[model samples]
Target chain A: MSNLEQKPFNVREIREEFPALRQQVYGKNLIYFDNGATSQKPKLVLDAINLFYSKENANIHRGVHYLSQRATTDYEAARQRIQRYLGARKSEEIIFTKGTTDSINLVAFSFGSTLSAGDEILISAMEHHSNIVPWQMLCERQGCVLKVVPINQRGELIMDEFDQLLSKKTKLVSITHISNTLGTINPVKEIIQKAHAVGAKVLIDGAQSIQHMHINVKELDCDFYVFSSHKVFGPTGIGVLYGKEDILYRMPPYQGGGDMIARVTFERTTYNELPFKFEAGTPHIAGGICLGKAFEFLETIDMEAAERHERELAKYAEDMLDTFEGLQIIGEAKNKTSVVSFSVKGIHPFDIGTLLDKQGIAVRTGHHCTQPLMDFYGIPGTVRASFAFYNTKQEIDTFVEAVERSLSMLK
Target chain B: MNLIEKQEEIIQEFEVFDDWMEKYEYIIDLGKDLPKITETNKTEDRLIEGCQSRVWLDSNFRDGKMHFTADSDAIITKGIIGLLIRVLDGEEPKSIATADLFFISKIGLQEHLSPTRANGLLGMVKRLKLEAIKHISAS
Candidate 1:
């Protein structure tokens, strides 16, 4: 009542808010367990997307017309919403791009442009391909060495190894806040402190963490944070890159066209200010508004309760699956999120995933775009059943039962 | 039986399953029955690309017939691979190259028919046809 907060954390009530969950696949109710890859959109965000297209569809920031002004207001307001959501210093700190991969590439190119030959960029072994490849490309271009912090069998980053890797020569330390495949929550706060000590800036890939936890860039003191709108219950093709205002001012424009310019001429060009310096072209205007609506939707939830429920789901699934003789849970970090990734001794994850899909219990299979992590475990892939707050234990029961049946058929 | 007859046989076999689980279980059994490619034959050159599961298909032409042996890491994929080989194997090279795989859809397995499906059935079929063309040109 006080602030339009969503009713207290009730899974049943919250489930009603998402319309996608009420569908059937193969005559069975769909049990979507792919939150790590992307979350299902809520009705509020869906309506916002439709409303923008139906009524407020116009190119933003340039036109003085009523429609453009309304679109610009909503878009800028969305930027501010993201800023407030992340506890970023100003709306100027939030720049929208085409999802997390684009966000990482922006930092890699712009911030990477600042680095010189022989300077090092440190990342962990568990990062998604987006985080790894961008830096690798940067290292190739700039002649900067890319060092990876190794992880234990439990899939946790070896902090001591990271400490050894972080030195004066290290220019940046980019790591994931949570492993999308393993659900291991990295100690990004400590990593930020250590990186700052060694005078290296840090970027936390919050593509997986933002939806599951509370993030305050000011408190975390990270140089940059990136996430995708689709992974946070918003529309696809849009994401955020939250960088410190000071750092963003120093970096050059990523793409040099359209909105990202201050003034353009035949002779010379000047880049735009803060966020606009990075955002080029029209951008996904509808996605921006809907993502803002998503953050507003997120405001209503009790994240702590939601997090606890998700953790319980993971634990409950893990315990149940462990009973099977050859099933091995991949990421067993003490501090993990609601992701249960497991491999059976003789079964390929693709087989399990295929059968699960036939039964309408959706899960992810294969390398999950982290082939190196898969190689670390000496397995091709694992069947990953990642959970969101809306998922319940009963669904877990069906999934476990389906796994058992699938195993029986495979065997 | 000819290629079309074999495909029709598969469709008829699948028609009796009232639910998907029973159908997939039958596929799993067929996968188990498929003669696996030799470890040496499962070389890099034999592996099909664009499949989520590793699929190694070995082809040979003898007695004017195109023979195919396949293996997959996943049982379900192997089952589907078995179904493909069932339709395409033991046929003349010309017939193998021109065969219509309409039964894949008829068997309620339309999901695997797309060129975009990561299981690479379409890719495997393409490879099988290419092998057939090679044999046909040689003759």
Candidate 2:
């Protein structure tokens, strides 16, 4: 068999890695296309979760007992793994968070609360609600201005417009490295460089990017980076925020409570060191520990090979769907991850999604949380099918067949 | 109106929805009859943060009744807002507080909304109730 056709890395072997992928949805073999929303967990991640609870379930950081020490070791080791996964310089730079939303909010409230009036925060038109809302709330509170860099018809960021939006007054430029709605992989390195030249911090939202691409934070030189663990085949309710050592040290604590404090008295208190300064209260301990297993699982795969395989499938799915009358694919970015958003003429996206679900070929239908992009396109929503490495060619074929069948019903 | 009376009013309003959908050419027409927000009153302060549609919301209390005027950039979303206004508009704070707008899942209106849109709708309802709570407490 040819490399792509070979079962070497096909769904059968890949399916074994993910316990959730074996189940049936609606009496049909579940074809999960919601990877962009959150990926299904692998066996390793699940085992890690089970293993943590079975052996080491105590609260982290404080107890001198065996369970607490082991738990602290596992949690910090997970942080170290993620640090290496993202190629961060130190483990101290990584802060465990609830997810990308929490990570962004942490930065906004902690870092953004310090900004002065007339300071500008630049973001793109295609940001998810999580990325957009936190900055807006910060702007409203801090008297800082929020500027948007527009995207072109193809859903790619207009570099000129982004350059135009950057200035000395810009305090931060937070942009999605890969759009969840559109599959566009942005030029984040250049975006970061331009922002940094003006003395502004840059936070790249990697909620969608981490799955498809290999990210090296040091190479990118982004001041801050955030991504949800769930999107990377890890457990939900856990994520990581990576900041440069200098910047993280200067930023204030996000939540004030236990574990984050170094010295506490009725009169005064001092915050803990680098990462724990931000991590307050009891965190999603099991989730954070399992996040390491997710990185380990991803490390085993040939990332380039997977990317090429999915790109080919995406293109094939695109061509097949294009054969249908009046079907338009949105966001045809030249460089993209494995996501396809499309709409059929004279049909609501929800109708198409419901029809697809009946056949067990799941897909997301709607704005995909980028409403400004939807408004720009003048459509109510688009049906989005996002692929992961484990997704098969046969699944794409089934998806196309289902789409055709669904369209016929609309007729 | 009392609890039983409000439930009856809701049942009647749902019955009128079919007729409203047919008679009105656009969702905004339904909105036009529900309430109004004068142009001079438009501000960024009233803009909802996360909605994909440009939803303009303005509220005022007149004679113990809360009035809301909302307009969306999209038609279906507008229709949804119209449905919300019909259910939520003009009701007293405590009565509107007890109303289950999520019950639209039973009527199958939310069947069409994506999870995100549904969440947005929920957020809008929460904002409306928050406004009501503000006024109710002030009084």
Best by lDDT: 1
Residue lDDT tens for model 1, A1-411: 113566679999889999999999999999999988899999989998888889999999899999999999989988988898899989999999998899999999999999999999999999899999999999999999999999999999999999998999999999999999999999999999999998999999999999998899999999999999999999999999999999999998888889988888999999888789898899899999999989988999999899999999999999999999899999999999999999999898888998999999999998999999999999988999999999999999999999999998888
Model 2 regions lying over 4 Å from their true place: A1-11, B1-139
Question: Stretches of candidate 1 above 4 Å error?
Answer: A1-3
True contacts kept of each: 0.76, 0.04
lDDT of 2 at A61: 89
- Candidate 1 CAPRI-style tier: medium
Query: Weakest 10 consecutive residues, lDDT, candidate 2 chain A?
Result: A1-10
Would you list the clashing residue pairs of candidate 2?
none
For model 2, report DockQ: 0.07
In candidate 1, residue A239 scores what lDDT?
Answer: 93
Alpha-carbon deviation at B109 in model 1, angstroms: 1.7
TM-score of predicted chain B, candidate 1: 0.93
